[model samples]
Target: MSPIELNKRQDTILQIVKENGPITGEQIAERLNLTRATLRPDLAILTMAGFLDARPRVGYFYSGKKTMTTASESMMNLKVGDFQSLPVVVAENMTVYDAIVQLFLEDVGTLFVVDEKSHLQGVLSRKDLLRTSIGTQELTKIPVHIIMSRMPNIVYCKKSDSLIGAAKKLIDRQVDSLPVVNETENGLEIVGRLTKTSVTKAFISLAETHDL
Candidate 1:
């Protein structure tokens, strides 16, 4: 799973909790000279992400679960094939309006643009559609290929890739997902999609296995 990037204050909050926990929210807030209300969101996020645990009256405490180094090593062992979802694809010539409809119907954040042979040609994202929609151009008149991000610009992965490596690409590229492809004589064939949700599921699976 992608690590949650904590802000300075959030990092400070975690340190305080680590050193003096089962500490109360109020006490934590006091140390930082902030209101309890102000610290509530950060505490909630840390707790939900499994960094901390809370008791009704006992307040908050670090979970002291597996260290980051150990968890990262386990995550590196995960393969993209194990966690990817089926690719949601659209024909390159498909109208932007139709692509938008297909996107919502499929409940996907991205649509892979493909040729007649199902070879990847480009990628269409929610941001792309939104940008098109707000323009004066008629959506139906425009083809997805016009606005889609085409290769050699696409970031992709193979089924054999490590999940951690693919996850890093997703982060560095700042894209919602990557097409999991298979190389063929013709081109790259879209076999699956590696997404943040997939990474999160992998992390949850890893956590469960550790507990077991």
Candidate 2:
């Protein structure tokens, strides 16, 4: 069945399974305020779609095999512009302490370091801040640019890249997030970011509907 044809209830069931795997039909019904009888059709359809699995006594669980395959397929189906978060950037001249404050305020793990023109310059992570903090040097005197991962070596995603592709990069590179860049006359400009947490959450959402 087309993804569009899946009703909201079915979608919710799949998501729940994805999030709380090895869940039971009764548990799903309780969460949705529906009866097991009413939810059977959805469970059946999701199982048929390779999105769910049924254990003898445990109830239902999401089939990881299906989740991975479906997530990959979904990623391939995305337009580059769809999965980006608006750029949250720090100026290169900003102090490490300033960047730390930004990181805390934004509740993000990384920050894009940008030049005066907003061109991609570097990337700063929480680790960098913590490591620097251990030294006797004053944070206020340390420039963020000095500690950031320099350009060219940075792994970035385009606004048009699929979420799966971005997630793969994050996993393979062992990075927390990727900056989304826009091609500019001078060079790539920082446009946004895609975090591993966000990608994982998306996958969990996708699995919530299945009974398994």
lDDT of 2 at 130: 92
Which regions of candidate 2 deviate over 4 angstroms? 1-72, 209-212
RMSD of each: 13.2, 11.6
Q: Give each model a TM-score.
A: 0.66, 0.64
**Model 1 agreement with the true structure over 65-107: per-residue lDDT tens digits:** 4434444555665678767888999998999999999999999
By lDDT, who's the top model here?
1
Task: Show pairs that collide, candidate 1.
Answer: none
Model 1: runs farther than 4 Å from truth? 1-72
> Alpha carbon lDDT of residue 118, candidate 2?
82
Give model 1's TM-score versus the native structure: 0.66
lDDT of each: 0.83, 0.75
10 residues in a row with least lDDT, candidate 2: 66-75
